[model samples]
Target: MGIRMIHHICIQTEKYTESLDFYTRILGFEVVSETANFHNREYNTWLKIGDFMIELQTPKAGDKFNVWSSLNGGPVHMGFLVDSVEEEYERIVELGYKDFKVKNGKIVYEVEGESLFKIKAPEGTEIEIRDTDIK
Candidate 1:
């Protein structure tokens, strides 16, 4: 048996438009397909970058888990590997986002000599940005 790379990551969000904007405009994920009222969802959007895809869905109205809340054993957060964490961090900051952790006026944080940073997604999910060459 062999294992391959991640196919996609699914995110449920009530802020459909905002999340779409965040992924498409800010993060630069191209929209592969967007369907309204797909499989009981208000919207089901498939966004892609390189070989990875992000499946974003909006739940039906009045759904309990429609809001951004931890699933108590679901994924804690998601991350993306980038060429340069510093460049990505600066680009995000230039977009007028202020959801990153800062210490000593620096948004990038070092862990065990690795350069990385975290930014909150529109739905409050922590998206970690890491250097591609990190070991």
Candidate 2:
């Protein structure tokens, strides 16, 4: 069987509201669908803007994973394909998001092809901005 495109990417966050704002406002992701628990609290949310679909989910009260813990040392990080890495990088910075690509307020020049940048999500997840259309 041939491989199809990625249907969605699931992101687990502790601060749901902040994460929602970061994705929708900072990155311009649109909420296409959502699922809430018995108390009408969001348990899972599907956000999309183009062919890309991102699912934001939060762990239960008795869940094992502690979302607040700093797991920044982990190598697992999600990447999003943007139209222009430089432009997206600037926009993310303007939105008061941390630019992990910058050093001491100086912007380093990136190579021509296969470029990428990083922006920290509200939940401390590294949201990568990649300059490629391959999904």
Candidate 3:
């Protein structure tokens, strides 16, 4: 159990501008990262309050689940902070869990230099295991 904390929660939204304003202006969350046309989405933004974060993503061009067709809002995934991503990935493999995101023959992937891996929960929520020691 190297997990340190619940890192962040992701929210998928069609009202990107409105949600961004609500989180930043109304709720007073500060933007940590903001990228346009990220992963084929209109915007991918990260807002934070102290150590915890909220990831807001606009609907992708071809979302398999039709995320926007329903209510157009809700959580998509959650990230957990870990002491060491490599150790956690190894532990997960040793525990016999077979489904997780992999890149270039490695289970751990890097996003903006942060090491992490994503796995789907039983009800289809994505869970990101991430290393907390960011340089």
TM-score top scorer: 1
lDDT of 3 by residue, 7-73 (tens): 8878777767766765565334799999999989988999997788888887798764443322347
TM-score of each: 0.85, 0.72, 0.47
How close to the true structure is residue 57 of candidate 2, measured as C-alpha lDDT? Answer: 88
Candidate models: Cα lDDT each:
0.83, 0.74, 0.71
**Candidate 2 C-alpha lDDT tens digits along 13-129:** 877899899989998999987788823334789899788888888777656555543454664677777778888877877878764745345452344556676667877776667
Which candidate, 1 or 3, would have the higher lDDT against the true structure? 1
Which candidate leads the pack in lDDT?
A: 1
Residues 7-124, candidate 1: write the lDDT tens digits.
9998888888988988887789999999998877899999999999999988776685634555657787778898898889888879877777565677787878888887777877
Q: Give the local distance difference test score of model 2.
A: 0.74
Of 2 and 3, the candidate ranking higher by TM-score: 2
Full candidate order by TM-score, most accurate first: 1, 2, 3
Deviation of model 3 at 70, angstroms: 12
The regions of model 2 sitting more than 4 angstroms off are 38-42, 67-75, 99-115, 132-135
> What is the lDDT for 79 in model 1?
81
